[model samples]
Every structure is written in C-alpha cells, then in structure tokens.
Target: MSANPSPGSPRVALVTGTSSGIGAAVVKTLCDLGHQVLAVDFNPAGETVAEASGAAFFQADLTDAEACRAAVGDAVKRFGHVDILVNNAGIQHVESIESFPEAKWRQIIDLMLTAPFLLTQAAWPYMREGQWGRIINIASVHAQVASPGKAAYISAKHGLIGLTKTAALEGGEHGITANALCPAYVRTPLVDNQIADQARMHGMGEQEVIEKVMLKNAAVKRLIDPSEVASLVAYLASDQAGAVTGSSWNIDLGWTAQ
Candidate 1:
C-alpha cells in the first residue's frame, strides 16, 4: 500500500488515453486514492474523466512529440509536479505481413512505442528533481507471445518491455521506478475494436472470434476487467512498489500460463 499523502499534498498523476476503457478506470482509481491527475487523450472523453474525478484534462495527439511534451508540461504547470505517468494510449492494426500497409505499421509503432519514449523523456526531469516517480507502461500479452496478423502491435509492445527495463535501471538511482503491465485481453474499447476487425478478417461471427481468436489460448475464459488492471496500476504507483521495477507484470487471465 502507498503511504497516504499529507493533507493537501495531492500527488499529480498523468494517465494517457483516458477517453475510455482501461484508461478511464485508471484515472478514476487514482483520483479516488487522492491523486490529482491529468487525463489525456485525442478524443473528448478525457474531459469527462477530468470532470468526474476533479482531474485536469488535455486533448493532445501523443504521437506528436510537441503535443506529448506540452501535455506533460501542462500537468506540471497546474499540479506543481507530476508524480506518476501511465502510458496507456495505443491502437491496434490487424493485417498479415504481406498485406500490412506500411503507413499503418508506422502509425501503430509511433503511437504505442514512440509516444511512451517521448513522454517518459519529458517527465524524467520532474521525477528526478523530486527524487520520486512512477512510470507504468501498459503493454499486452502480445509482448510475450505472437499473434497472427498483429506484427506491428506485438513488435511495439515487445519493444516497450525493453524500454521499461532500461528506464527502470536508469531511473532507480533517482528514486524513480519504471515498469510495464502486460494484460491479455482486458474488456476495453480497444479489444472491442479488435474483435470486429478480427471477425471480418477471419470470416467468423463476433462470438466465434471472441471464443477462438481472443480466448482460445487462455486457460481462463473470461476477459480481464479494466478495474483489475487499474488496481494493479494503483499499487505499482504506490510507495510500496518502489522495489518492483524493471518488470513486466502480467494481469492476463491465465492467457500466458498455457
């Protein structure tokens, strides 16, 4: 458990992709726990998260380096300093190697991998100055295993694991920790989009896609809850998790167990 902040100390957290799903849940969880967060997304849903949680909201395309830096700067300007960063913004593309569009691959890699790198770089000075920070990258089970027609997503996630480890090693000296959460198929808007894409690609009904494409390899049948992932993110951001860096913690519902 994290130590409670002194009355009015209000820690500042920035959670990306707060428009919906896991990102929204994480913003709520952090707010309920007493952090003043900066919820960010390209979509307008971040404004809702901010309103409901009393967090500040920023609409920015994180794939743009300037936008990424400005978002982090905005949070620091408002909250005094940023204490935690959750890089949860991402998109998925489904295509075989032969058919995968070059542009799509670049877009996915830029959003999923490059954006985290830029955000983390921008947040580093603040964390180092405070000598405390938490950086949680939301990776996926694809970080560990291969899935057909998802080369770019898988590659970016896997690269994120590398970035997490390297950041952990470097940040530890400054009392900052970095880690990645690798969940399987969390019930989220992202997964919903993927289900539709997969169903069409495989010529199967959505139900068939869920059973075979999403859950077939998992030991547990049900999708993981967004709240569960949020709970883990909260723990990781806490003082109790200081020793838990350079790790890829899986919240997959037995997906990788097999």
Candidate 2:
C-alpha cells in the first residue's frame, strides 16, 4: 500500500475536464479525501464548479501542447506539486470512417491522445521528485471494443491505454502508478449528446436509442451514474490501491463479458 501524505501537506491533484460529469465528481471526491486539487478544463465555466468543489481552477485548451504544460505548471505553482493526474477531457465525433471529417479526426486525436501524453510528460518530473504519484486515465468501453461510427474516439481511447501502461512501467521505480478506467455509457452531458446523435443516425427516438443501442451490450440495462465511476476513481487513487498499476479497471456493467 502507498503511504499517505503527511499531515498539513495534503497530496495535490490535477484533474482535467472538470466542468461536469466524471471530472466534477473526481474533483469533489479528491477534495473530500483531503487532497488539494487543481481542476483544469477548457471551459471557463468550470471555474464555478471548481470553486464549489473546493479546488483551484485552471482554464486551458489542453489540445494545445503549451496549454497542457501550462496546466501542470499552474498546479505545481499553486500546490507545490501534483501527486495525482486525471486526464479526462474528451469530445465525441460520430461519423462513419469514410465520411469522418479530417479536421474532426485531428481534433479528437489531439485532444484525447496527444494532450494526455503532453500532460503526463510535464507531470512526470514532479511525481518523480515527490516519489509518489497516481495517473488515472478515463478511457471508454470502446477502448477495449470497437463500435461503428466512432473511429476517432475508439482510436484515441485505445491509444490512451497504451500510454497508461508505458507510464506505469516507467514510473514504477519512482513510486508512481498509472492505470486506465474503462466505463460504459454514463449519464453525462457528453453521453446525452451522443444519445441524440445516435438517435439521429439510426432514425429512432432518443429513448429507443438508449434502450436498443446504448444498453444493448450491457447486462445491467441501465445508464451508469457519474458517482459510480467516481467511487472507482476514489479507490484507485487511494493508498490501498498502490499495487494496482498498468491495469484497466472496467466499470462497464458486464458489457465486455462476451
């Protein structure tokens, strides 16, 4: 098991995509655990969410390499160092591979894959210096299995898992651990928008899309709550989970059982 931070010096965490959903829950969970947190997101609106959650907010477009580095710097500047890093900022583009816009593909890859790498590179030294760190990547069920009309998203998520393993391997000697979380559909704004898009694409009602498309693969047949994912994040971030590294934790409601 990992050792907890000394009293009066709470572990500092830097989490991205904090405007809503899993990111927001993560911020709250970390703060409640007595960790100092710096919430980073492209949306300025996240500042309010961060304030409410007792975390410092940094607004940056993580797709930009400089911005990614700046976010890590901002966290270190504010809290001395970052002990936990959550790369969760993501966007979805639902189109067939043939009709997928070149620009959209680039944007998705840049935001989801390249940005995480940039942020990890920037945070590595701090974690190495501190001799303890946790890197939790928010991947998707699509990372393990491909889906139609989501080439860019699936590709980025798959790449993220690879990055997690590499980080875990490199950071092992330095007391840092890295892992990925693969979740099925959650009740997030992003998923809500996806439901709409899928409905449009399939020419079905939104409820039908949710029942027939989103829940079709899951044995639970229900949308996952953001808090459920956050609870898993809490466990992975805990000192007790020190031995867990380079593993992908699935909160997918048995979707991948087949």
Candidate 3:
C-alpha cells in the first residue's frame, strides 16, 4: 500500500458511465486496488454492473445539474469522502454540422462537457478538504484530432481538453490533480453503439467503419481494450502520480504521432 491511499483512507472513487464498457472496467480496476467506488449512470443496467463490481451505484441522468450534484452527494454519503473522480459519462451523436439536430447537440454538450464541470465543482470541496484529489476525464482522440461528420463530438472533446488544462492549473496549489485520457477508438459499448451510425454516415459496412474509418489514422491498427485504459486510470489515481496534472495523456496507438 502507498503511504496515503486517498483523502484520508482507502481511496473512494466516483466513476460515471459505469453501466458498461470502460466505466465498468474502471470500477473493477479501482476496486481491485482496494478503493471504494460509487458507480453512476442513467442506465438501469449500471446497477447490475455496480453490484458485480461491489460498488455503490447511482442511477442518474447527468444532463441535469442537480442530478450531477446529487450523484456526488450520494458518493460522499456512501463513502464519507470522495478522493478521486473519473468523469467518464458521455454519449455519441454522429452527423454533419449542416444536418445535426440542435437538441442532440445540446444534449451531447450537456452530458459530455457540462456534466464534468458540475461534478468537479461539486467534488472540489471534499478534495480540497482532504488536500488530495484526482480528476480523470475520459476524453477521446477527437479531443485533439477530428474526422468528418462528427461536429458535436469533436467539438465537445476539444473543449474537454481545454477544461482539463484549466482545472489542472487551478487545482495544482491544493494537492489536486486533473488530467484527461485521450484514447482512439476503444472497444467499448460507446464505440459499439456507433458502428451502425458510422456505417450509415460513411456508407460502409460496420466492419469497414472499424477498419478504415476508425483505425485508418493510427500507426497501430487495433481497437483499444477498456482494460488498457483502466490500467492508466489506476496509475493516475495513485499517489505516485501526484506530480502529474493538467495534461492530456494519449493512448491512441500513435494516432497523433503524425
């Protein structure tokens, strides 16, 4: 065990989007390291995943600010303090700028970008109180690079990296660290849910979307596993990474190397 686990004890991690995929993997990763996790997601299925991971689950629609606040409150109530926050809640909408639905764009912005802000705003006090905190945002390669027909997604992800940098600056003096994980196409339900949509938009088969559309830019052509990302999260949330903050760590198969 490290010299100090979290805030004051075994770390308590609050991970959103825990219903499946990377979120579930993160919950397991943190738990295996002896941290208590509060898993939050609007999906009812999240409760099952939470149970399996031995985590406390909060079913919440994070698009609502109050719901964002309440989820953090529930985490504190369950574990007494929040030591780490993994802002992993998000949804994907694929469409060109000219035809994308306004409501869908707003929802994606609210859920993906706005929710992290509110959750961090709410969790900051607990972290500051303990003089220790970790904020990990699950951004995408879209945060730095872009593709056609994904105006909202690319925009939101780009903005998330900006937020990550700003938060890192503000949290530095308080023993709080904020960082973003920018991964290429990871084999998560989030990516699976988009295959049919990408196929329709690109006029290609689902497999083609995975190969050409998804992996085309990467030097290493493979879908990143959720466990691979989880391992990084575990390290960032650990005491050894205390000096690392305000950075966007890319696990993108050398996609951005060019």
Off by over 4 Å in 2: 1-4, 7-9
Ranking by lDDT: 2, 3, 1
* Per-residue error (Å), model 2, residue 244: 0.4
Write candidate 3's Cα lDDT for 64-115 as tens digits: 9999999999988877878899999888988889999999999999999999
Report clash pairs, candidate 3: none
lDDT of 1 by residue, 114-216 (tens): 9999999998888888888899999999999998999999999999999999999999999889999999999998999999899989999999999998999
Candidate 2, position 140, lDDT:
93
Q: Please write out the lDDT profile of model 2 over residues 26-129, one tens digit for every residue.
A: 99998998889999999999999999989999999987999999999998887777788999999998988889999999999999999999999998888887
Quick one: RMSD of model 2? 2.5
| Models, CA RMSD each | 2.9, 2.5, 2.5
Q: How are the candidates ranked when ordered by TM-score, highest leading? A: 2, 3, 1
Candidate 3 wrong stretches, greater than 4 Å: 1-9
Q: Candidate 1 vs. truth: CA RMSD?
A: 2.9
Better of 1 and 2 by TM-score: 2
Q: lDDT at 235 for candidate 2?
A: 81
